[model samples]
Target: MSAARDWLFADIGGTHVRLCRWGRENGAGDIVRMRADASAGVADALLGFERAQTQPAAHAALAIALPVRRGPLRMTNRDWILDPESLRATLRLRTLCVVNDFVAAAAGVPVLGERDSLVLREGVPGPGSRLLIGPGTGLGVAALIGTTGGDERVLASEAGHMGLAWQGAEIDALHGLGRTRWGRLSWERLLSGEGLGWLHAWRSGAATPAPAPEVASRAAQGERAAREATQWFSRLLGAFAGDLCLAFGADAGVWLTGGVLDGLAETFDAAAFLEAFDDKGRYAATQREVPVRRVLAGDLAFRGLARIVDGACRAPMLRLSAATTHRHRN
Candidate 1:
C-alpha cells in the first residue's frame, strides 16, 4: 500500500460510533472525528461517514466495535451487518480490513509512546503480552500477544458477558435491592459508563433520570451519591480488570481506557485498585508487577487502526524471517 493513500479509520462501540481520516503516522497522528452517534448499527453509523466524505481511491482499514471477518460482520451490541466488499465497491476503495474494536484499541497501545500512557504503577513491561479493557457504552476487553520475533497479535474477548459474581455484602446488596429489578448482575452491570449511573441511582435511591456522562459529571462537580457510586464502579472495574490480567498473563501491563475511566477519578485510586487486583493470593505479587494505566487522547483509535494495518502488512516479513531462521538452524 502506498503511504500517501489516506486510510479511513473508525471506532464503533455500544454507545458511540466514530469515523475519521488518516493524518500522520498512517494513524498514529491526528484524526478528524466525522461523527459520533449511538451504535444502532453499522449501516446507520457509516452513513454518517458516507454523507460527509466521498470514497477514497485506496484501501480503507476499518476498526469496529464488533468482531469482523473479511466479508459480513455482525455486531454483538447491535444488529448492524458490515460487508467490506459492498462498502468498498460503494466507496470505490481498492481494499478493506475489519478489526475488532478492542483489538484496534490494543494496537494503538504500543504506538501510544510515553505521552499517551498514564502510569498507575512502576513495572518493567516488555511486550510479552498486554491487556486492554475499558468501559464506555460497554465493557470492552482485548489482549496483545507478542511473537518471539516481536510481532504483536491482538486477541478480542467477550469477557463482559461473564456473569458478575458479587460476593458477601455485594451479594446482600443485590438481594436487598431486588435482583429482579437489576436484570441479572453481569460484570457490565456495574462496570460501564451507563452502569455507573445505574449504580448511583440504585445506591442513592435517587429517582432522577440522566445519562452516565451526566452522572459522572455531576459526581465530579461534588455530588455525594455520585461519588459513592463511582467508588463502587472503581472497585468492580479493578476486580474485572485484574481477572483479565490473570487470564492473559499480560506481563506487559493492563490498560484501562475509554471515557468511563477518564470521567471517574475514583477508578484512578491505585491503592484501592491494586488492593482488590492483588487479592489473588499466591499470584498476587506477580500480578502486582503488571502496571495499570488509562489511555488519554482522542486520536488513539485512529493510531490503533494504523497499527493494525502496519502489523498486518509486516506479518509476512516476520514469518519469512522465522522460516529463514529454521532453514539456517537445520
Candidate 2:
C-alpha cells in the first residue's frame, strides 16, 4: 500500500461529486465539489481533477452512491455505467478502491467528534450495531458493528429499496401516485429528494412538481401544503428509521446525515419525527432506548474516504467481470 498522501478520494452521489487529496498526517486537503455529470461518466470527472493538480495521484478511492459489485455497474439515479478495470486503466491508477457511499459514511461515524453531531434523543448505549442512514439525491443505509477485539466492521445495505412500512389512506394515495409515475413504490420513492417533491405535489395537488429545495423553502415560509409535505416526510423518515433499528438491532445509536435533511434543518419536525420513531407498538420502549443524532458536518463521506486510504478502514477494491465488460467513458 502507498502512503495516503499519494491518493485521491472521491464521493460520487446522484447530484454531486466531492473530491479531495488526503494524508494520514494532515487529514484531507481542500475539497472540490461539482455537480455530477452522469452523461460524461465518472472517469472524465476524475481526469479533469487530475489535470488540475501539479501531480496526479497514483491511487484513488471512490465512495459511490450506487451498489459496488464485481462486474460492470450501473448507477441507479444516474445514467453512467462503470467498469472498474476501465476506470483504473483510464486513470493510470496503481490501486482503485470502490465502496458504497453509505459505507464510507458509516466508516466516518467513529471519527466524528462532539461538534460534528447533534443528539436528537438520548438513550442508553447497548452492545449492538450502530446504524447510519441519510437522504440526498437518493437514500443511503449502512450498519457499523464493533467486535470485542476493538476492530469495527461496516455492512452496506440497499435498505432504501425496501417496501414502505406505513399504512393509511394518505400512504395509499402516495403509493398510487408513485405507482402511476414510476411503476414501483419503495421506501426511497418517498424518502428522498424526488420523494419530497412528490409528496409536495400530492399535498398541494399541483400539476407540476416543485423541487425538493423549493418545497423546503416554502415549508420554512409556512406554506400549508409544503409544511404538511415536509412534516409527513419527517414522520415517515422516523418510522422507517425505527423499523431499521429493530431489524438491525442497532441499539448502539443511529446517525442521520444527508443533504436533504440538512436543508430541512429549520423546517424538520423533530417532535413529529421522534413521536413516529418511538411509535412502535410492542417495541416502543426499545425504540426510545436507541439514541438518535443528526450529523452536523457535510464532509462525512470525504472523511471516511480519508480513513480508508489511511488504512483505518478496509474497503473492497472494485472488481470487473471479463464477461460483463462495458466502456463507461467515451
Candidate 3:
C-alpha cells in the first residue's frame, strides 16, 4: 500500500469512534471501533489508530459529530476538542478533510440500496430535497439538495437545538419538567439516548432516571411507564421530523438513522410514529404523502467518507491561511 494512494477515514461520534482505511484498488477495509473516551482527545485517538496500522495513510477525511467551522472543533455531547491543522501535522497527512457527521451521512443517501433502508411510510418520490435526521447521544439534521446538473449539495444544520413545539397537555407538562431540569428545552433534550432516560424518569415519577438501554429493556418487558415513555419518544420524533420536512420542503423523502432508533427496532411502533408525522393540520395529507424510511445500514458515515476519498463526493478540505488561521471551502 503506497502512502500517497491509501486514505484513512474516521467517523467520530459522541460515544464511539470508528476508523477505517480505504484504497483505490481495494476500497474500504474493515472498521475498527473504539470508545470515544478511551483516548485523551481526537488527535490521540487518530494517532493511536495510525500507530497500530502496518503503514500510515497519506490522506485522511473525518466525519465528526459537531459543527465543522473554520478553526478548532468542539463536540456538542462529548468533551473532545479537535484542531485539524495540529492533527494534520501530527499524522503527517498530505491532505485532510473534516465535515459534519450528518453531512457525511446524508452523502450516503444517494447510494442506498433496497437493503439499506426500510420504508416507514410510502409516498411519491419527487425531485425535491431529501432530509436526513437521526437521534443518538444527540440529534442530527442534514439536507441533500439535488442540482439541475445532477450533482448534489449537502447542507449541515444544528436544527436539533431548536425549541421543541408541544401541542397537548401531557407534552406541555413534559416540556415544563425538561425546562426545570435543563434550564432550556431543545428537541435533543427529549430525542437523544440521555433524553429517553430523562423522559422515562419524568413519566414514571422516579427520583432517578434509568439508562436508555435499561428503559428500552423495561419497555420490551411490558413495563407500563417505560412503554409509555418509549411510545411518547417515537411520537415526538415523528412530530419533529415532520416539522423539519416542511421547513426544508423535503418532498423527496425522509431518511432516519441513529443508535437510539436502532436499539428500539424491536419495539418501535411505526404506525404511531407515522400518525404523529402526518398530523400537520391542513398539510396532513401532504405530509402523509411524503416518503419516510429508516436506514438499516450500519457504519453509514464511513461509507460516506469513502465516497469523499474516492472523489465521488466533494467535501470541503481544511486549509491554513498565511495568517495561520484555518479556512474551508463551501
- Residue-level lDDT of model 1, residues 141-166, one tens digit each, is 88777753365567778788787855
Order of all candidates by TM-score, from best down to worst?
A: 3, 2, 1
* lDDT of prediction 2: 0.83
What's the TM-score of each model vs. the native?
0.82, 0.93, 0.94
Best candidate per TM-score, number? Answer: 3
TM-score of model number 1: 0.82
State the weakest 10-residue window (summed lDDT) of model 2. Answer: 321-330
Q: What clash pairs does model 2 have?
A: none
Ranking by lDDT: 3, 2, 1
Q: What is the model-wide C-alpha lDDT for candidate 3? A: 0.84
The TM-score, computed over Cα atoms with residue i paired to residue i, of candidate 3 is 0.94
Best-fitting candidate, scored by lDDT: 3
Off by over 4 Å in 3: 1-5, 147-149, 314-326
